[model samples]
Target: MAKIGFIGMGNMGKAILQGALKEFPKTDFVFCAKTEATKLRVHEKTGIDYADSNAECANRCKYLILAIKPQFYEEVLNAVRYMLTPDHVIISLAPGRTIDQLKLNLGNDKRIVRVMPNTPAMIGEGMTGISCRKEEFTDEELDVLTRIFSSCGKAEYIEERLMDAVVCASGSSPAFVYMFIEALADGAVRCGMPRKQAYIFAAQAVKGAASMVLETGEHPGVLKDQVCSPAGTTIAGVAALEETGFRNAVLKGCEAVYKKCIEI
Candidate 1:
């Protein structure tokens, strides 16, 4: 019998599978894809097992990851409801779905965990936010779930109320970061750098800068000051960013994402 089963094999689902496989090499995993093409693709790529249907997947695993889109949650959960037992834990990756809503579809006493994980998980550097009631899960069960998340990157348990914020901060922020990298590369190209080389330079600089923040344990402002010498070129660039209201723009973008997540 599989220890865990996933109900989707999309990008995020595949990323989570890659991570979990590394952490649980001895554990059997099964996934139920919507089509035979995807089912064959996932199994061939990852060497993991596949189930013919959602109910079959649910029946074979103790932990079922509901990785399908929010729109399909009702159908998927309804299909698997009769197979779910009290011992099963439902780990949901849909953004707007809540534990309570899941219980209404599955069972009132069902254990559920809602999580937000980003695309970076494809590279084993994902940031995931998880929410679960302490009483709903045993300590060992929680640890296994957390380890599955951490295998890709970082995982933190947060209050369900803050899940929307997590969506804004990490779930949707990778797109914004990619935009910034593209803009930086464009600027370099404008200054006579080769287009391909420009992207490498911009991407590495962003990666290194982010590493410093995680490793230094200092305020970002202080780190900025460290880079900006008196009347230096860095200060000139900082002035331009300030004049363009870069920080405000990012904050407003996050606010917009948070608003949209709540709507969903």
Candidate 2:
């Protein structure tokens, strides 16, 4: 079993830990947060060990996970780079940090993987996009991480170049989807339905719709067509969305996110 060490225990970091724990029951794990308070909270909840320092955790584990915020990458790299060697496989969950950037920070001679994971990883239904341009992760490593992540949600090895778009489409879009769901529920409540019941219906409808698309293996447009019987309520709603440029808004949002990633 692989020894996995998590270096940060923030939101997504916590989600990753939860996902890993649920997915890989046999893998031994250790983790350290930047502060004692977070460590204590995690320990109280999960009964996991808290390493004294990042370097101590990195040195002790064969697989190291860097779950820090983008702002602290440099500091953490400075603290733990010495502990990272060729034998260690490091996964970075920070956005906009390219594999090249990670290599430069850690060292020229190290194995690194960059992963773009969404917030839903908490519920084991997250979508994660991974890439390692420099380190050719073997089938075993790929399978290992895939299985580990599958326990949390779905993961795929994407091209580094596509990561920016992936971040826009999957990583950051959850916020957009949430807002849409909230608005849908609000509309329902305005129409006299109770707020909580509206939320339950709206959330489940969205979930069921997504599941239909996945299970039917059909294009979204085709699945949407199946729902819009000629001149029906669904068609009217879709027409309203089109008139309001719903697709265009999503495209522009993705464009903005992609540009921001490039700037970062």
Cα shift from native, residue 21, model 1 (Å): 0.7
* lDDT of each candidate versus the true structure: 0.92, 0.86
Candidate 1 steric clashes: 0
Worst 10 residues of 2 by lDDT: 133-142
Q: TM-scores of the models, in the given order?
A: 0.97, 0.95
Off by over 4 Å in 2: 25-27, 133-135
lDDT of 1 by residue, 1-264 (tens): 999899998898999999998989634799999999999998888888899999999999998998898788879988999999989989999887788987887789889899999999999999999999978788999999998999999999999999999999999999999999999999999999999999999999999998899899989899999999999999999999989999999999999998888788
Judged by lDDT, which candidate is best? 1
Residue 168 in model 2: lDDT: 99
